[model samples]
Target: MEIQKNLIQLGQSFKTKEEAITFCGEQLVSGGYVTPDYVPAMLERNSELSVYMGNFIAIPHGTDAAKKEVLKTGITIVQVPRGVNFGDEEAPKIATVLFGIAGVGSEHLDLIQKISIFCADVDNVVKLADATTADEIADLLNSVEV
Candidate 1:
């Protein structure tokens, strides 16, 4: 599946994972992609999966809600000033969080997987976190091959 470049940017500039998810949900709602009721559920899911991987990175996501609608499946990237715990017992300075939300039985799993792989690289994660604009982040993502 061809990942939408705009969607990738939507996931990379949130102030925090929570903000990212909320903002993304709002965007989806405004864009007629999802219903407003789905936001709380998504937040709950994010809270449940918050995990901090050392070096300022956290991958937070929801459960089945992610796969509820193809249009709802999107990744949100958040940059925090002080960072959050992410439920990690040690090394929890995660300043950047990536939230992956998928629709039910999403056919875009490949795209999601590709994003996961791209984010696994510490250098890339750092670059994404440091990116100054959506276009910059898009450029960074474009440089990565699926």
Candidate 2:
């Protein structure tokens, strides 16, 4: 899975989706995957469009213009076991998993596909949400193939 090679923070507790977004975005930027501007770009884009990808997962990606900010293709996954609201009122929509992806060109499609495969099974998503540690979460994703 695309997430296997990227940074992962598990069992985190963020009071808001914005907090989670900022945390993960900064991580990606610091890791040299994306420019610092990409973080704010992602937040702005998310404000325009909901990133909730179903199954209690919110995937935040930079705007098309912000693509220039990406230096490498990678994903920073932040799992908040307590969950965070993503501008939704539905009870099932509070996302417990946050996936911040930096895609270079067509890499976005591949990255999306990888995430689709990773979340194809509800049980897998549930297992991922309930994972106790970053290592466990990484091992779970690393065990899957896109």
Candidate 3:
């Protein structure tokens, strides 16, 4: 799947996970990747379950049934420097970045694998979180070995 260049957002600082998640969905929606309903669906799932991936990243996606809300397979990433808490305040699963995926069917798995590879290395994850420009983040993500 081709990654849309406009979906990347770097140097973000969200106070809460909700805000971060909403921004991710908004980015995807603004990109015409998924419908507005897809945002709530993704948020609801996030509320019901933690979407945190290791290496300080969270991969958020809508429900499986919400695939119909997606216009095309796409991805939007937000690098949150301050990070966001995905668990209890005292023991939070803080994430340095959020990768919002608007995928159709099997493309979901592919996106996850690709993103996983991107974040597999601790240095790559740190680079992404600290990236000052969108182009830097996009270039790093685009270089994922998949």
Please provide, for model 2 over 10-123, each residue's C-alpha lDDT reduced to its tens digit, 9 standing for 90 to 100. 778977778888888997987799999999988987888878888888888888889999999888888888788886565546888888888889897787778877887888
Ranking by lDDT: 3, 2, 1
Worst 10 residues of 2 by lDDT: 1-10
Best-fitting candidate, scored by lDDT: 3
Better candidate number, 1 or 2, judged by lDDT:
2
Q: Which candidate tops TM-score? A: 3
lDDT of 1 at 61: 43
Report, for all candidates in order, the number of backbone clashes.
10, 0, 0
TM-score-based ranking:
3, 2, 1
- For each candidate, what is the lDDT? 0.55, 0.81, 0.84
Candidate 3 lDDT score relative to the true structure = 0.84
TM-score, per-candidate, Cα-based: 0.64, 0.89, 0.92
Better of 1 and 2 by TM-score: 2
Off by over 4 Å in 2: 1-6, 89-92
1-146 per-residue lDDT for model 1 (tens digits): 32344554433444445665676566545545456766666688666755444456554444565445335454444444444444435633455645344443553455556667877777877777777676776676667743
Q: How many times do residue backbones clash in model 3?
A: 0
Runs with alpha carbons beyond 4 Å of true place in candidate 3: none
